[model samples]
Target: MPLLAYWVTYASLDRAQTDWYLFWRARFRAGEPLPTDLSYIFLHVYETLHGVGFNRPEAAFAHLQRLWRSYRVDHPQLDHHLVDWLADFIRYYDLDDEVTRAWLDEAWVHAHGDLAVHYWLERGGGGEVPEGVFQHLISYRPEQNKFYRDAEDKAALDTLLRRAVVLTDSFYRETTGESVFERLKTKATHTVERRAFSGAVFEGPDFQYTVATIRQYRQDGRLSKLLTQAVRHAENLARKQVGFRSLLRDVKLPANLAAYLDVHLAPALATLQPPSPVQTPPAPERPRVQLDLGRLATLQQESEQVRGRLLEETEPGEASTDLEPSISPAVPATPALPAAPLAAVHRPPLPAQVAEGELTEVDSIAEVLAGITDAARDLLRQLRNQGWEAPEGDLRLPPGVFTSTLVDEVNEAAQPRLGDVLLQQQDGRLVAVDDYRNELAFLLGTPEPAALTPPLDGPWGALAGLLSPLHLEVLAQLLQTDLTLGELEVFTTARHALGSAVLEDLNSHALDTVGDILVDPYGDPLTLEDAYRDDVRRVLHASGLVHPE
Candidate 1:
């Protein structure tokens, strides 16, 4: 109908008295070929008929069947949408007659049985399948359905198949006196060959695959061959160290087969043993030596007396008030020892006092050393005694003190006078920089270290005269070990200047003084050339930048 005539007819009709079926039927037949827009209108009519059709089951089924057949070829998906409707119709109206059964079978075939299968599985696969529905499901082939061939659809189908198998197995067992597999195996003509096995039954790899495959075979009514194949495959895989116990836990089998498999496999499982663990021998304990406290105190007093006498003798005519007299008045005073010859007394150079109340470089260095805490001083003494390097744990520090923080404190205290950091941490140990070893010892009142002599003649002597404190410090660091750019940065002036700039300045000084670049400026880790190492050390020692080991 044209839009004008269609609306005119709809407006003229008394809705309560109008026959909607005949009205739509006339509209559908008016156009020799139905208009495409009328298809939705026809579906609406079908829905209306379905909703009201239950009151007259025969009349509704006949009308829905005629509409379905008329539209099914052009609208194949119409059957998919009608699956639940048809199922409900048959179930609600109790329509199990031959005519209704034939119509439902044709519908199932047209819809590929996906919705029909889903409908039954949704109901827990219980109750009797309406006539023809079971036959269609049993005869349904998944490979032919393009929808089921898709990956997602295939997974859904597998889930449905598993549920169906479980439901069928449960129902069959409840209805009959035996399991599905037990009844199916009665027709087996061949015997299952037994094999030697050392593992428990159903203990193997790919157990899920075995279980799923067995379920599929059960659905296909082929359990007789499946049981024999599963046992043989499990035994073969067990020989290669795969287990099969997971399969039996997931898949139930006939009791006779279970007992037979257990009898053969359990003996081997019992004989298997786990490997023993290896044992290690215990380490020997170190001996502990206890100190005699009384003897130690006496020795310490005598040592203090000897040190006071030495200080008194070294600084003649200057009363050494640094120590109190340790000798007891109860004992007679010992005769004063004869003074040593002047040539025998080797006094280290002491810092000169400033008259203007301003510290000179030497006084500043001394003051920095004097300000060191007893803990820091002890740490330094240990490092010096251990050849200037000791594991951080071996050095005694107060609780809650970190070695790096202590090193930074000492270095910061000395930087203005020393012109560089004096201590470094390397490879988990505290190290006194070599350049300040003797200077530190002299300040601490320890014996002076032996002088290390390197050739200072000719060009080397000139180079020594030209090097600055910072330049000498940089060379000394490189001499000990090659330094990365970041490590060299610490020695740069103010510790903020670029390492490359420091190298350029040093190279310029060397090129002017000795006519050679003493260190490689562009190496990945900067290195001092071997030929110039002796000359550089001689410069360091000449300027008192480094001390002998």
Candidate 2:
């Protein structure tokens, strides 16, 4: 299956690398070791970070994280070839595994502390670490390595390192205490020789020396360039394999026969073969034979009566007729079965069915909304009172509107139910979905509310109708974190428009739509730059399918 998928995506190198990664991931899961060739893993990591493999880099990070965790269970130490790439993966994804965190910390302390610390700092860890670890993070110097690259790259790197140092110090001081740096220094008094000043001297030629040299080359940032070359080589090999496999699948030939022809007959077939004239064989006369015509006629009549009797048994109401007495004729068509009843038609379950455990078919919108939680009901009231009006349809509300007024109120909204009631606009506005408007009015006891016939298309279809593709994607992302306007600006602009000017226009248009969605009916309208949260995510898991409470 992996090979077939690889063939389908043969043209794309990134996709091929992703396939190769998954192929190995399965092996790791089954307690098998990975291939010695590190090219496949490196390419997968690189492609995933760049968002080429697996469509989303986050997904790629997750896959690699699982693979690493599984592979490390039996192995005591990581492969030397994987350290740099693994470090890059960790930096890009900010992985949270405790084992990985400890491994990275130890690896940096014992291996290339100077080079790895930049990535560590840039990634920005969430939790606290030992004070000595911060000292190592801030104090390491790249220039200590004799094999370090020239001054041109060094200057830029040094500037970055200085910035990282300041950031780390500030962060620790703020999070810990004013005397944290001094405490770190006191803790580092014992291991000063091991971590701080150990690798300045050159070791003579040996297996360990060779390993150290290779590690230096990688730390100096040369391995990534070599990995790119390896990727091209692997891609070339993959293309040939895919081409051969495709030929085999399409030719409908046995594997051995195909191999035999390619090996022995291919050269011979290359040269044109002369056409040979066809030969005809003469016909020979046969001896005379005789049959009784009266006996054959009697036998044929008996056979027809037997077939007619069998047909009568199969079709009770229809009368069977005798077969025409001939050697060959066209066959008659069989009778069609009766159509199925309307009740047997496969119609989807109504909205009432989806809400069966928590809500009833006849429950009012106010009652359902209130049943979710007090926070949820309050969120709806805020939307109803403060939501902005769309140009042509219902009022809309952005997540930010709720977030600005009530602290953590967005977490209170049930996305499943909210998705039932709120329609998503292309610009990411949540307008009260029109499908439930009448149902809601009825639920709220509005006088003379128009009777609404529940949609027969089913609950899922109705839910799908409430949001566009982009809305669903954005909502899913929001379940993880509140998306900033700058991120949204980049995302919407890159995806929806072509030119920079048009992208800017679209960005502005999106902001305007957001304003309409979060109009704040009783106060000042909300801006796009304001922080927004997904209330549905508060009640739902990352899958966005199951409600946690």
Candidate 3:
């Protein structure tokens, strides 16, 4: 119809040529004999016949017969097309009769199928099929499962099939009170077995598929790319190791295909071998981070500023008195009558500060300390909530696993390793966010503190029951080995924190250990400073896990 329309509109032919083209087309459509004048029109009619033939074969057949009658003798080219179309019809559907036989005898042999024979069998209402030609009609093994490249994959498939059979057997026996295992086994063995390329079942290697079809099957959706690669590798292995050339001798395939597999495919598969076992991966190296003592020093300075502010707030009335002596001048008593102007004098209110909930921002020492405390606690809670536990005894974590509230400069400059303490900057002041000393001691690998006191029932009570975090850390280390005074000082930053005030606090908690350190063996008591440096170490070791060696 479209070709007819094109000629009518665009050909610009005379009225006679237009009528002649229309007459032939109309004659073909009307099932009338095509005029002898337009003999070339048979080819165009056959092309149209093929387009509409698959569903309406009877109408297509009428056109086919007419076309064949017109050109089958002289125009063998048109006969070739007619034979090919008939072959397709025979392959896909049931057809028979003298007309079918005539076309079947003229069919072309191709890679596809036995088109003529299949059509004859279907059209004759089915009969005994000849030995090898139409075996795919009964049951066909998909090219995907014909052969496996991987031995492991083949084994897995076999296991799945056996399990499926067992499950089906169990279901049938329970439901029907009869075991169908033997019957199903025989049926599966006969029907599911793959046919050899030559149509014999048990005459060739287990795999009978062409590499071309295998490649196509591997491109399918269910198989992953990795699986496809493995299959390809297995195919290569089987060709070399399984004696593919020797196996191909027993089977039948196209000469070209067999030659390609042996000459091209065999060499390719041999080169693509599995990896060697000797090469092992190296262990991963961890990143390093530097701790910033400068940040801690700045925090200490901010703490001192906060302390000064707190002292002034506590004695607000004395603030003016303290300044009065330095002023050396005072306001006269005459100012009492000029109170109205003094009251009217505009003193702009303090600039509004950023607020969060009920807590408004304040430029005071106490508020600064409070902010530090809140930030520290919030950070600690966050780390804990995110599964960062306070490990006992020398915690060594990966770099950046636990984050600190330090400024970007500090964080970026160094990668903080495990066992490093974290500090946060709050309101321009740095404060300890987590206690690393005891946490390190409590880590799984570190030594435990001497259980001097009775074991506590809870995590907090246990930590609080022991010596302070610093002392606990010292004890954990000392338990492993004794260290000289200089070595101990170098081992930790806590040595600087072990001043008289801290010693006194420790003495209050562990009175017996402190009392023993205060007195000398000669009955004279040592000074607090000397006692801390010398006697305290001895006394602590005697009381705890550490013993002088």
Candidate 4:
């Protein structure tokens, strides 16, 4: 089902309105709340975060939080629950997982893109955005084509995108840079190819069996449209092979005879002498002529048999020997040894008071206003002192015309903190430069790296420092660590049941099964077909349809 319910709402409600619309709407809708729609949106939020497990968690949470905050201000009625959800987000954040990055890749990064806008209008806000306050909250992703965008509150979507890039880069470094793919192939292959080169294909199952399996998947909605297409292709290829076999069998030709005939038969036939028209010597032929009807019948029977076999031909153990063998991916019958319990990933079960934390709320708007103003002044001084740093070959930011890149770009209400920044640029210069650049810049008059210390702030700060938008993604990691360490029996039981190898095992499994299940694109962009596969998987997993495998 779609994330939001389809309501023929006012088409023009595209911006955040501070007016008491949510309050009145809540009263009007009352019991008939948009539960399914709300849940759908949450699931999308959840699914995207789950994909971040392929990357980072804290970063992911930071992004989600930004979105939650932006979308929830005018949605004050939902804020209480949403805030709780946000807290939970921090609780379950995992630093190394792709769940965090997944949210951005699938949603936030593209939130304001034109496509997101259209999606929101055509899909999301069947209801309109309220009419006031943070009206500009609605941004468009030209990337997705100009469409009405969705925003409940006002936070910077561009900021979320920048943070997402950093988180993605970090994930790439962790999962790909230092022998990740090699290790995955190495480890996954080692586990998968245990019965290596036993020369078995989808052992025991014949082609009919494979075809039957695919057909069943289609019937059960387990196979997506794309996968169905692939299955059809495979079927077509098999059928063609059968046709070829039948032609060869009936044509009474050598193994290569068909090709030879196709290539040379016509030319050779051209060289043949025309039929002689001379009167026949009839007497000699009439003497011994006898028709073998029985033999002809036997020959016809043989041809029919050949055709039947050809239609159901088998290629033996050719392809799929190593990929998904007939015997399950990992034999459930292996009688897995009761291994030590792995740690459980959890919502911060720590008492709310304890888990609640010291990252003081943005305190008050007054403090934010002062801090933002001071940061802006300090930033200007820093900019002037540092001078333009854009490379000459690159399209340059004109000298002295300070571009609001990172913290400087943020309004007086949202100055980035030390840890909140992953990276920042100044006139195309790295504002939050890395250690190497910090060292180089320090030597050449740059400032000290703010994040050189362990990330001291909350997940949001760490995200800014680290660069991510998923709210509390860092906290999620902390929670995951505790979860892994906690001798929780439930976590162990869950992992065993799901057969997971990662912290976000259930989330991963959700992706695994749901990732392949897609609604018909119904003539959408071909590239989106791939993205939709990813999206559906994430959504399904988040919704708990695809359990962890």
Candidate 5:
């Protein structure tokens, strides 16, 4: 029968009526060369078998394989169509196992590369295929295929890009002994194939994987985008290093690829110049008060004379007897008080009431004041006369002396002996803390002001007096809220003291006065005992060391 007649008869027959083997055998044996347009026959047969369902995939695949092997040589043009249909049959029947894959490749995988890739990808695109086959499959850029075009595939691409960066960074580190990624260690166990690229060979077990992945992107016309991203990533990795440009220059890539990276990375390199040193403005000059010493002496003499004249006019009889010297030689006259002595005043002799070996509290405070500079005494005197708070300008500071420094000097001297800051600067005014007002007045020889808060009596009062200023400040902060050792250190460190020592001192004093430790020294966050919290608070409040909440 004519080829056309047989083809028509085959199409007309149902599966039950047709003998696939005998029918094709007769045509093959006819010896009239197979027609170039025999793909219809292959398609018709594949459809017929597929319609029979995949209940017997092996039989169906074997039948298609037989037809392909039988006619593919005579009808070379039909080979592409037949192989495609057979691959589709194998895929549709889920026969894409090692057996069928070998069968399909032997049939035509070499001649039809795209179909081979499609077949492989349809099988989830994993496992080891022939290297040449893999190259051909990846060469087609399967990631752009509709089946692989999703976030998962994009992530795969990103993963490959990152591997490339790490490999490249590893290459630089190995060749130049410098790290581009700043990684101290690497998992690159594979020795570099020295001649693989132009400059340096990258490391890592994934080197072959990275090469294939990169080749796929390169074939997909995305190499530039990939390299640009890689260059930017490397730049970020090396941004903090002083040798970024050198690191980039040492990147082990082919000349052209390295040049491409350089072009993209040049703009960032230009901006990476070492940062300029910051310039600080100089402090402004202070105006020095140049005093006329002779004129000051004349003014002082005039002021004293005016003061004596006014006193005589107000009480002539008392003034006469007080000012006149005693006539009798046997009875010595009491020496008059000296004029306002700014320069040559001496510390008062220890009071007779103070025992020779022991320093009384008043004498100790006086000693603290006596150790301070004349400027500090003057500042204290002004604060005392002005109700313990006065503007900085009214304090009569000496030339080149600042009110803050003088106050610090006085507080430092007093803190060691008196155990508290005698003076503090607030709102540009020198002020004495209310708790120390009486002591400050007596130290400066000023009349004592009425106490703002009455003194704490009994053990609480004694404990308050015994506690150092740092201890009180720490206690005050704890009274508001319990403090950690770190928080307490902030208060003590400025005073060159330790928080633990302050607590120890406080507990020691509490033992002596309250007969029990007030603060729980072993607590994580130091806390006062519940029984003594109120009493401690009351003592601090009454002494004006700490105020009511």
Candidate 6:
């Protein structure tokens, strides 16, 4: 309907001119009859007759008469259709009649009076059959039975005969107080004793019909598609394994379908193939960060700046004679009054940390250490290929880094890694944001360098942890084997940590932390100097970083 509407709406053709319509137009206009085998007519007649029964002669006779009237002798094609239709009409109807009479004959063989047949025969009222018609039925039935038995083909009503016996066995058991099984056995024995086993009683299983088996029996072409669909359903249900579906597609049964197919197909079906496996990828490498205070001094001077500021104070009255000794500023201090021109100098963005002038003796030392720290971080970043080269000059640090209270803040921030020792003598504040990268060896305190701890992560008694991340890794590498400073730099590269370089450089400067120096790999009583040298020797031996011996 949608197709029809689409054509009507879009194409708006005056008429359909497909081959069928065009040919039909010529034939009708020319007064030519439709060919019997024209696609339409054949389908029409064949479809019309499919379910019309041929169970009786009268039925076929009526159909034949109808066809005769419909056929026109002038139209040989239509006449030919009637002829084929009649031939089929006769075969089916006659075969049905023959089957009905044969069933009756089996019940009344010899002179056995079957009240059912006599009653039905009398009701059929053919007036009088031929004198020996009853005899003929008897003789024909036995003869057919003989032919069937001789050819081993007496299965015509094998199902029906079994059905009748089942009914009889039930009747005998239910109505006569006899066991059904015993009654069936008794019937079978009598038949054999009478020497009448041709199509006789025997042990036969009750016949069951599946829709598929019925379709196979009929050999129905249209039903074949439906059967194939059913087979596919079975196959899918079993995940396309063998067994029932395999036997269903067989042309005919051999021996027994269940037993044979089970033997062949069950095992095949049971062995279902599994899906294939998938592969996984490898892990990525970690980032490397190592600090070096000495190399940093090379980048920017003022190693003492942050250390100086760390001790400086911003609070009122904290500046003393030692720190505020006659200092001058670009702007004068506010007059000693609330309404003065300005109460405080709105200082520019202070040094990256603290003001150098505010620094005290202890803060001065911390500021220098802080400067060293800043330089180290810078150098490590550069090594990571940040590509920020240090400008050549006196290592003067940038100013804002030394804001009045800022350097102390930085010292406090970096203290966790460098330790409270780097803190001002007054308030030992920790400020290292990421202290994990600091030299942990001092935190876990020991005379022996090997006693150099990794990091005090948790309470692990007697096992002092090194807080310096660089020291731990470099130590780990040295533990692997000895290495040198120049070589230690290469070890730093492979370790992929700027922290490794940071540890090596600290030890290299020999001013703080372990370095590329030599000592017992074990925690032998060695100063930072000796341990530093041992690491340097190991790095050298490993041919890690290239430099003169």
Q: Candidate order by lDDT, highest to lowest?
A: 5, 1, 2, 3, 6, 4
**Which residue window of length 10 is worst by lDDT in model 5?**
207-216
For each candidate, what TM-score against the reference?
Answer: 0.21, 0.17, 0.17, 0.16, 0.24, 0.14
Query: Which structure is stronger by TM-score: 1 or 5?
Result: 5
lDDT tens per residue, model 5, 200-287: 1112122111111111112222332333445434443333233311121122346544454445444434443443434789999999
TM-score for candidate 5, residues paired by index: 0.24
For residues 1-549, write the lDDT of model 1, one tens digit per residue: 222111113344354424553465566545333433333434443443344434677766666666555676676544543443454456555678898877765555332222343334444544444332333334222333222222233433343333343344454566687654455632212111111110111112211100000111112335423443333322322322222111111234555544444444444434433223336778888899999999999999998887676765655455545476543224568999999853332335655642321222344556666666777777787777666766565577889997877888888887776655668765445677543555556656664364556546544564564454456767988889999766776556333344655675577446433556777654658889998776677788876667655
Q: Model 2: per-residue lDDT, tens digit, 114-183?
A: 2233334334632342232333332222343211222234433333333333333444456567422332
For each candidate, what is the lDDT?
0.50, 0.36, 0.35, 0.30, 0.51, 0.31
Best by TM-score: 5
Better of 3 and 6 by lDDT: 3
| Residue ranges of candidate 3 with Cα displaced over 4 Å | 1-382, 385-466, 494-496, 499-505, 512-549
Clash tally for model 4 = 67
Which regions in candidate 4 have their CA more than 4 angstroms from the true location?
1-444, 447-549
Clash totals for all candidate models: 8, 5, 15, 67, 0, 81
The local lDDT score (0 to 100) that residue 417 gets in candidate 2 is 39
Q: Candidate 2 at 260: error in angstroms?
A: 76
Worst lDDT run of 10 residues, candidate 1, spans 207-216
**Cα shift from native, residue 528, model 5 (Å):** 2.1
Question: Model 6, which residues run further than 4 Å from truth?
Answer: 1-272, 283-313, 316-549
